[model samples]
Target chain A: MRQILSIATTTVGEAIRRRVLLIILLIGVLFLVVAPGLGVLSARSETVVLRGMMLGIIQLTSAVIAIVLTVYMIPNEIERRTIYTILSKPVQRWQFLIGKYLGAVFSLGLMMALMTAVLVFVFWLQASDQSLAAVGAMVKAPTMYFVQMSLLAAVAIFFSTFVAPLVNFFLTGGMYLLGSLFNPFFQTLQENQGTHPVTKAFAGIVNTILPNFANYNVQNPIINPTQVIQNESRYYLEVTFYGLFYIGILLVAGILIFDRREV
Target chain B: MAAAIETKQLTKSYKSRAAGNINVVDNLDLHVEEGEIFGFLGPNGAGKTTTIKMLLGIIYPTSGEGFVLGKEIGDMAVHRLISYLPERPYYYEHMTGLELLKFYGSLFGIYDEAKYRALLEKVNLHRDMTKTISQYSKGMQQRVGLAQSLLNDPKLLFLDEPTGGLDPIAHREIRDLILSFRDEGRTVFISSHELSEVELICDRVAIINKGIIERQGKLTELLHGGRIEITVGGVDEAFLKGLNIPDSNIRGLPVGVLMDMPEEQDPNGIIDAVRNRKGTVISVVPRRKRLEDLFVETVTNPALGGKPSVPPAVAEEIVK
Candidate 1:
């Protein structure tokens, strides 16, 4: 545990200082600050459009940050020979993998927290007629996006143990896209009575294999205040646990591969 | 002395599409006694690093067995007593020398600030303890690496090219520190290409070529059959050769002649001949066979333990 924490803290220190991640974060913040002006062009209510646009920027930015941060996490350590120094010590391979994953999560959370703060300030500054309760509700989506990005980091880390950074980048990005956009379309197809048995079976297997990133996507209800979710807190808890469970499995698989890898 | 490390038929092989089952480290045996500096010498891609990694438990051996500190290889209990510093290691640049030590120290659950300070002082990095690795010179980085390797007060230290690519002063500094490891009763295993550096520090050495142990013995035993040189000022190369000294090299110097021959041969017969010719005998010097000569002879020739083997392609390349 001590070894894992030490590696984790060191990883966090390195990740936060990376110029590429900081640049991505800066761009995310910039878009959030300017989102209110763009909301006026949309046909919907200005505040509603502003809410959706800001949340969309945060989700997109977090996904990119998660992928970029984790793709090279294992490979860079090997290339730089840092992993040898640590592994030659009493540290276990699983501990190092978990420590690195946690470090990526912590760094991602820090970046998302910054964007979330910016979102609040932007909403408060531009949507002044809105109530404080509305602002609080708006804060919930970025919080869930944090868990979504954490899962995404885990996906990248799992692939990184076996694949090169470039390939892992595309693979993890593709997984995210499939889970976010097409997962629901597939889910609906599987449930609809008129769907073919073959298509339903395929959807079932895909759903079973791919993590439902759409689980944490609670932006629509927050975007339009008229919508109501009866079991809001229960749903939040279930998705957070689901993300954690999936992250756990991916990490275990990654550690198994990394243990045998002759780095 | 008890053996600190011993191996029997330890091997590591990799399979490739074109070439099948290439043995990076073939059936090999090695021995390192407790509290001695053992030099592991080899050319590039000669399996020095692979052997070290297997011993360190960073990678598994394909077949065979090994022991470290009287424990089986890859034992976690053994790791607590051992440390490894690889070639050209990169410390976390964001960390100060002190912080780097702290982080590695924490791996062993050690939180003693005084120990960290003492280690820095031992490596002569006490003043630079607060400086991040990015600000340190190459020598300083290597020094800090040594400091971290000592965090556990290890019984064995494996250093791969500890003084590689450093200036004279830095080399001397690192060499002195390695020698001090022996004094402190620590077993030091070094894999290096710096022959002169190894000659200065290593108590015993093993030369491996193409993953096979070609030579292994004490420094003094392996380096034998030294040469004797007799220099005369007035004598020319032609006159020196005329003496017909057997098993000797007669060469012309800028202002004199030099006769180099085996150590067992007498120097008086040559001295009398040079004096009778009025060729002033300027000097007589006995030179021991150097490690470099032994390395070239052992690596280039395929014979080991009186058994002939195939020469490596790299050795042939060297001949060219």
Candidate 2:
């Protein structure tokens, strides 16, 4: 446990020193500041437009941050031969994977919190009237975004354990795109049940294997105050837990493969 | 006593589909006794690094069993008691020397900062501990590398070209440190192309060539074969006549001549041969067998000329 924490701390320190976390934070803040101005030019309702823009920005930024940082964690260590120094110890392979994952997640979590705070501040500045429920709903979008990014980070790490960083980057991004498209395909399959059995079955298998990142998109519930937040809280927590579970599975697989690699 | 390290028929082959396969190490046996400085001498492409990697469990051997500290080579517990320094030390460039040492110490489960601090002092790296490893000279990096190896106070240490790039003073310091390790009853296994350094520090030395052990034994046994050189000027025929040395004893050289005496023969016979001659003797230098000469002779001769057979007892003893 101590070794894990030590490794995580070192990872965090390395990330901070490299200015990766700082770059992500600066970009996220800039996006939040500019999001409200973009909402003003939209042809839709003001609150709804602002919420959609904020959610889209958060998702895009978080994905960029997670993929860019996590993809190089293992590869950089291997290239530098720092893995040799760490693996020579009594620490298990699983511990090293978990430690790196947690470190990356923590870094992303810090960025998410900072970006979400900036978005909330912008929302508060533009609001004519604020309610407790409205504020809570507005915060849920970035919170869900955090969970999705954490899952993406794990996916990047999993691929990094076995392949090159550039390949892992594209592979994890492809998985994310495929996972996000799952919900629409599932709805389509349900609408055309008689026509698309084989396609529906294949989509179902992919949905089961990859994380459903689209499920965490909760912008409409917060933006359109007329619509009830049906299943919002339960689904948000459930999807967060689901992302955590997927991360755990990928991390285990990574550990297994990395353990057998001759370093 | 059990051997500190032993390998039986150790072999390793690297396979690449695009390129021709090459066997880095093949059908080799090696043993090092506890408290002895064993030198593993080989030229470039001689599988020295490959053998070290296998012993350290960085790379698995294709076929063989190796033991260290009476335990199997790959065992983690045995690894804890063994320290290694690679030919080129690679470290985190961002980390200072002290930070790197602390990280290594933490991995080895050593929490005492003072002990590591003292090790830095011992390796003469205390002054440069605050500087990043990337900024260090090759010799300075080697010093830090040596410091890290001694962090756990290991029972066995493997150093590959430990003093390869060091200046004369640093090289001497490292040699002294290795000798000190032997004095404290720890085993030190070193691989180097520096024949003179190996000869100076190693109690027992092994000369490997083409993935095989050409000769291995006590330094004294290899060096004390009793070869001498004699030089004299004027009256060549008279000097030859005065010396009744057999043909086997007298071998011709470019400048002067070489004399090979039986193991039991005294130097007095050569002294008498020159003394009774009607000529002024310039110099009668008694040539002792050096590790460099031995290395050159063994490597140049595919079948070393009438070399003494390696005793089976020595091989068996190292295995145990």
Candidate 3:
């Protein structure tokens, strides 16, 4: 456990200092700060537009950050020969893989936290009604996005063990897109009684294999007061649990492959 | 002394689409006793690093067995007693020297500040502890690598090219530290291309070529068969050659006929013949064989074969 934490700590340190991640984060913050002015151009309510725009920026930024941070996590260690030094110690391969995954998630959380802080401050500064409750509600979507991104990082890490960084980058990004945009469509298709059996079977396979990133897209309820999540606490807990379970499986698979990998 | 490391036909092979089943390290049998600096020498791609990785349990052998500290390879218990510093190792550049040591030390669940400090002092990097790795010179990075390797106070230290690509002063500094490992009763297994550096520090060496052990023995015994060069002025090349010295080369220079002969044969006879023939014995120099010569000879010649070819006396002494 200590070895894992040591490797985790080092990974976090290296990840945070990576200039590419910092640049993406800076851009995310910039967009959040300027989102209110852009809301003026929208036909929807200014608050609604502002809220939706800021949440979109945060989600997109976090997804990109998660993918970029994790795809090279294993490859960079091997390229720099840092993995050899650490592996040559008493540390196990699973520990190193878990440590790197945890570090990526932690660094992602830190960057997302910064963007959330900026989002809160920008929303607060621009709002007509300033309520602590409103700000608190605004932070919840990012919290869930943190879980979604954590799962995304795990997927990237799993592919990183067996694939090159460039391929893993596209693979994890594609997984995220399919899960986020198409999971609901597949879920509905699988449930439709009148649907063709072959199509339903295909949908069932996609739905079963892909993580439901849309489950954590709880922004619509928070952004528009008219919409509400039915049994909000149960929904939040269920999705978070789902994310963790999926992440656990992906990590186990990664550890198994990494244990046998030459690097 | 007991063996610190022992291997039996340890092999690591990789299959390629173009080549089909390439043995990077084939049927490698190696031995290293405790408390000695054993040099693992070979040319590039000779599988020195591959062999070390297998022994360190970083990678598994395709076939055969290896033991370290009397435990099977990959035994975590033995890892607690061993450390490996790879060729051209890279530490986290974002970390300061002290923090780097702390990080590696924490791997063994060791958080001792005093130990980290003392190790830095041992590697002569205590003053640079505050500096991040990016601010360090190549030598400083290597010194810090040494310091981190000692964090566990390991019984066996595997250093791959410990002094590679360093200046003379840094080379000497690392060499001295490695020698100190032996004095402190630690086994140092070094895989290096620096034959001269290995010659200076290693008690025993194994030279590998094309994934096979070509020669293995004590440095002194393997480097035997040095030559004697007798330079005689006022002597014709034909006259020197007519002396019929065995395993000798005679070259005619403008000022002298140089007769290079085996060191075992008495050179005094050649010198006497040259003088009696009215030739001035310009100079007589006995050149002892160096480790570099032996390494080149062993690696360049396939006939030396992959086995211990130690002189009979030295072989017996090593056995006892």
Q: Which sequence of candidate numbers ranks them by TM-score, best first?
A: 1, 3, 2
Off by over 4 Å in 2: A19-25, A45-50, A120-139, A183-197, A223-229, B18-22, B167-169, B207-211, B219-226, B233-237, B240-265, B276-281, B286-320
Runs in model 3 lying further than 4 Å from the true structure? B229-284, B305-320
Backbone clashes in model 1, listed as residue pairs: none
Write model 1 residue lDDT over A20-62, tens digit each, in one string: 9999999999999999989989998898889989999999999
Going through the candidates in order, their DockQ values are 0.74, 0.43, 0.72
Give the per-residue lDDT of model 1 (tens digit) for B140-160. Answer: 999999999999999999999
Error of 3 at A13 (Å): 1.2
- Per-prediction TM-score to the true structure, in the order listed: 0.92, 0.84, 0.91
lDDT against the true structure, each candidate: 0.91, 0.78, 0.91
State the lDDT at B110 in candidate 3. 91
Worst 10 residues of 1 chain A by lDDT: A126-135
Enumerate residue pairs that collide in model 3: B213-B306
